[model samples]
Target chain A: MFGEFNLIDKYFSARQAQRKDVHLTLGDDCAIVKAPDNVRIAISTDTLVAGTHFLPEANPAWVAHKALASNLSDLAAMGATPAWVSMALTLPHIDEAWLEPFCHAFFELANYYNIQLIGGDTTKGPLSITLTVQGFVPQDKVLLRNQAKVGDWVYVTGELGDSKAGLDVILAPEKRQEPFAAELEQRHYLSTPRILAGQALLNLASAAIDISDGLISDLGHILHQSQVGVSLDVNCLPMSKELRQFAPSIQVAQQYALTSGEEYELCFTVPAQNKGTLDSALAHCGTKVTCIGQIRPQGVFELLNNGQKLDWALSGYDHFKEVK
Target chain B: MFGEFNLIDKYFSARQAQRKDVHLTLGDDCAIVKAPDNVRIAISTDTLVAGTHFLPEANPAWVAHKALASNLSDLAAMGATPAWVSMALTLPHIDEAWLEPFCHAFFELANYYNIQLIGGDTTKGPLSITLTVQGFVPQDKVLLRNQAKVGDWVYVTGELGDSKAGLDVILAPEKRQEPFAAELEQRHYLSTPRILAGQALLNLASAAIDISDGLISDLGHILHQSQVGVSLDVNCLPMSKELRQFAPSIQVAQQYALTSGEEYELCFTVPAQNKGTLDSALAHCGTKVTCIGQIRPQGVFELLNNGQKLDWALSGYDHFKEVK
Candidate 1:
């Protein structure tokens, strides 16, 4: 008859922190959190499933990291500072070995971001994780996709397509059996560093979105929401040297960079006046911020190669599409 | 191919009232919610599985209602006003018939509480639902179980054991099939009303918690967190007449009232001076508030019958326990 009390005390009770904003935490019906006076809260949610989102044998630590990081990236896109989170975990059974590393990784990231695990629910089912995160931004400071005005310069943080290259190595390990492929495999397993740069660009950027569904597809979200279009130079798409070397061809590499997902980088639009400020911020943060394209009044997305228009073959990874 | 945009627009988007606190809602990477100065946010999450929490054939509307209502009850217990919610839904397949009713019931309750569904994630899997609800309360006004003190009077809203009685009717439909047994069965499918009564009691009450894992078990949480003890009157335990009529004996009815989970009523403690104010608030709310026990100096919880202590069972529903 081990009831909710014993289960909570045994597994989750002591792991919480004592904070001024946390009036109540684990062992109660719900947890309470205090918000700062001048900050608005940003929230996002994501769910990951075994077999669908990750391999069954993937490290539980990585699984925990990726799940929380993915949701946090959404907050970053909105130029919000990480604050708190709640997790709902469903598992086939409780395995102590798996729970230890999973909790360690989860708490490590949470502590790094100063985010508290305020509340959660646990149940028995196939392995799945759902995370909802709360973040804070000054009033009216949130970056929104609909705010991208025509002539705003589009920029992306960090190199793209590395995750896609990593995925290729994982899906076809035998095809890339060369010794140098291990680095590619690591990229797929560990996601990109979160774009904390959005915090600095909050006042400067007109619109922003996280790169989770490839450059072309996620950029489409900003375009559709802002009721505008874009014309990107294909050569301008940033890629890691490691990604270029592992890719099958230059065209294939370009296509993967345009359509790969899980990069966790920020794609934002800044006014021309703020270009120097953005460059200075990026240099101070030691992260690359590339100006890839600009917003246009037209309603169509276009790609140009060597100053000539090229027909794009793929849009991005669509969830309902037949897997390639 | 279905991507994130159409998935959200077609299935998740809805017209919600423009909340003064919400700067932005769905269709963005994250939702922007304003938190006023001097207000603390309370957050909680819960997940429901098809076969474990409800029958597979359960009404979709009730399933959706119970899922969100149960989480909202946690907010009510903390005396927090509902503000935002996000859902994670996994389904074997999409059925329009099921989705329409489910969404209707879900949105109906959300509207009633003025809580908006700001964001969510949907995927294919076994039928499961995870909901995270956000609530706001004035700074220093949030109720917590740890604030209860010795000499405080313990109280509860609404009767207990009706849900368990309803479950009995559902589990054994053929035993002495009474007229309106179908109505009794409906109770199992329906959710308990949240006791918004806590909002009025926040100033008067010393501490509070929602009774989801029965009165005795849930009170233990408050006791443990507050470092206090309780002496409950077994004769004062409230139960519906229908529950007593259906139970095998008075002791069984008492046990059910003390140990059944899913009541969703609030259990709270208040200073002796505020008893009159408590009566007025409950009266104005049109709900019954009963004083069944009192807080005591640190010790084990006890049950008294006619001024004499009685040995009682301490057990309730544990989600991870194996069914007999």
Candidate 2:
């Protein structure tokens, strides 16, 4: 029970009281939030490593962009409008030239979203950034993980596995070809957090989550939390042209799509009756949503292509579990 | 302009719209907070490096205790009653034996304060802990650094230099004396945040800050923020019997008292009118209050003994500036 994931549950979750104020706390993207004036707030914390999450010698702009974007993605999953942020930056040393572009990119996204950098700590240490973001949602409209129904339709915004391909391009640009590499790396470094889409789905989607981890692992969370299963058609897997071109075959591209992490896309569930209105609701969000699968009453997450079952052991990016 | 400290001031703090909701946002012990129901909340972030903040071989219990206690001290400075916490833990690996005591010590203090561990992220990295603590302070009652006035009486709770003496013992236990070592080490390892005293001083004190980076540096914050200076009585430093016994001389003990960090004791300023009520107000907090000095109208921080001025180039711990 004291495994990497369950350590938090055993130690922290087991002892807490049933706080009435907390709408949804641990085991989700964001933390407990109970605000007032009919606008309850939500909060989430994420930490990014310089050498691990981004390139060691990365564009400080991308470092700043991804650090804040990933955290905002958590808020987007919760159907909250971001309002304030507290950033704790640990730096090996202060590099002024590197910081200018980094700060420019961080505040660019922050200002566009009207989020204020309320307070933070600048300490000398390893190169890492930890951001805690707070956002506002209506009192009764928060999208939660446990609300998915068995008959709900599974939907994901934008293409999945593109960022993973982006990672491949970033790791070895010399091995990667020209045009595809640029797009793949762009998606990898600059995946937009679906904040508007989250708010749009607040009234329609029964449950929601962001795809930071690969599809299988991230979707498995919904299955476990909602106590429902899902069945997806492998043929419907949305692989990008860049990813498909980069892969050896369609099967490999599908594998990457299913198991690649850091996509920053929204995977959510809409009830059968609400499915018709889902597309129209998110039309203004500037992101496309595709019907990927349907929730089932029983059985584990399954994949089928042309009526043939396909099995694979797939997981998202886990820091503790070494992946090679 | 963009030095180590100013990097935050120039970049993060420079471009922010002052929302009316945030009473005190940047440049403080805690983040900006505005809550409803007559109880505003305070948030503060702190990151402790494994080798930097504590001994690498420090007991797991002490690691957890100091990590949480230090964050709580920030809320104490803001006169906030702690309510919730979000902890992001970076560890090289999971050691169950190490975690048992760590979680035990963490939850023990959390339960005592009635604070809930709402959410957290556990990741694999070098050992470090980043904790963001949220606490409720009454509207219009939060203490700030800029509230100090000319001629205000300055005071600190409990002894100042005991913790630093304890750190010395921790670094070189073989060279330290017996009975004195345990007491000093205990003070160093476990510092009680003066929460009750902070709340008690809300109506009595003009300004307050937790002595984290030594009295000289921390009090300097109050002086710079309030635009006032102070002359402190050298002989009046509240040094413990253990510190005096362990120190080479009374002067070295005073040196430690003036510039030692991580004390967790509060250095606060009370207006001249509230002087008489200060002792009675904080009497029930169980920490003895010591009047070290009085605020001056001008000039930098000064130390005085009887009638003569004692000068020493002293500063609290700085992560950027190396300390011998």
Candidate 3:
């Protein structure tokens, strides 16, 4: 036990500098965090099981980064500034080599966002990680999915489908690697940029959600919550060149673009009147914001290809569905 | 997925009314909570895996209560007020019967403490629960385990060793039902009352920790952190009459008393000068505060028996150690 503690102290403890808001940190049974006045705290939690979320032999650094980034994306979706996070990590054994890179990458992302590692539990079990992240939002300014209204234009940040293309390469390394396979793999490992674009869109977007379960499925959440529907332009779906190159067919590329999971970009709705301002904010943030659809009064989702409606075989990734 | 969502709405949603500090409750990616002025939030998290933490056949309600209570005890140790908690539950299947009672007991405790269920993630996996709890403490009055000084009186709330005694009954139901095993079995199901008494002692106690990994091991943490030692009166170790009757011998009961885990009582250090005030506060809270021994400058943990120090065979429960 002391060996484990010392290992954690030697490698992970000082990797990230303590933020001013953290009154007390890791060495205690719990941690103390101070929240400034007039700031609402947004909190979200996510758990990743080894076999379910990532390959057992996947790079530990990327695993750590992706796990933490997934939860941070939730904070970003809420238009909140990342503040602190508590990680509950359970592992079958402690590998110093794995711990070193994992902790380094974990803290690198944490420090980049100025988020403090407040508290958590480390125990022995199947490799699993549960992270509860806290973020701060100015009073009356937090974003939600239920706020979308009719005539609001739907927009997304960054390209989608690239992550899924990357994951394909990761899960099946034996397959012949395409010219863009390496690039796709890199996207799979690194998470989408979040805090900056989210902060810039906070005042402009009416409703927003991070695209985790692909664009279509995740967008369905916003539509359901807001009691609205959407008419999406299939041709407007964002796709990286790497995804297009690796996709077996145009249909497959479109399917992956619409339904691939682990893409942490934000899909949001904004009134037509605020489009100019939204565009300006995106430009200032230096992030791509593509208008792909519009919320409608009728509660039905439709996809238009060129001038005719088309049916896509797959809607989005569902945990219960058979994996492709 | 919708079924699980409905179950959550039915069972967990209404309980939000019990918490006054919650600005926004469930149904969002994250929950928002407000901290009172002059109070710093104390946070802790714990993950309990099925088979590791409890028997697979254990009642769901008890499992839920124990999971939340264990984390809540961390707040109690710091003399903080329980404010909110988020629970992540992963299970192989969704059984309505299991969820109903589990949520019932969970909210019962949450409502009693006014700790709201803010936000969490639910997914399909091995039966496991991760609970992150938040508590509030006056900025200057948070109790820590590194403040104990030489000569401070060592005190503990409630009786110890019952949970371990209860485990004995769980391991052998037939023996558990024999003669005096009924009460021990009952103790296994219901947990120790959290020490609300600690709130008043926050300013009086030098250092504190919750007794989870038995008295000997858990108190050692305080001693190690504070750079002090302790002399415990073995004869003064508290055990329920039921535990004594069920044990094979007094020595066995003593061993269990010193080494059992899951006793969620606060173990604290207070200056001898503050003994009277501490006694009064415990009495007012209707909880027992037993002065078991005193803190020493530096030495090995000593067990005083018949006015002479005696060697004890078993140390406290070490998670990494093989079970006897």
TM-score of chain A of each: 0.91, 0.85, 0.94
lDDT of 2 at A294: 91
- Top TM-score model: 3
**Across residues A229-294, which tens digit of lDDT does each residue of candidate 2 receive?**
888887888778988878888988988888888888888999999988887898899988888899
Residue A299 alpha-carbon offset, candidate 1, angstroms:
2.6
The weakest ten consecutive residues by lDDT in model 3 chain B span B315-324
**Candidates sorted by DockQ, best first:** 1, 3, 2
In the range B1-324, model 2's lDDT, one tens digit per residue, is 002223334323443434334433432212223457666657777788777787768898998899889888988887777776767776666676776678778877876776655555566666778888887777567778877888999999889898888988898869466779988988887989888998898899999989888898788767766778887998999999998998999999999999888898889999989999988898899989999999886564568988688867676423112211
Tens-digit per-residue lDDT, A223-303, candidate 1 = 777788777777888888787887778888888888888888888998888877877766665668888888787455667
lDDT of 2: 0.75
* Stretches > 4 Å off in candidate 1: A1-20, A173-176, A317-324, B1-4, B173-177, B307-309, B314-324
Clashing pairs in 3: none
- Against the native complex, each candidate's DockQ, computed on alpha carbons, is 0.73, 0.15, 0.67
Kindly report the root-mean-square deviation of model 2 from the true structure over all alpha carbons: 10.9
The true-versus-predicted C-alpha distance at residue B66 of model 3, in Å, is: 0.9
Off by over 4 Å in 3: A1-4, A173-176, A316-324, B1-4, B193-195, B316-324
Q: Which candidate's lDDT is highest?
A: 3
For each candidate, what is the lDDT? Answer: 0.78, 0.75, 0.81
Candidate 1 recovers a fraction of native contacts equal to 0.84
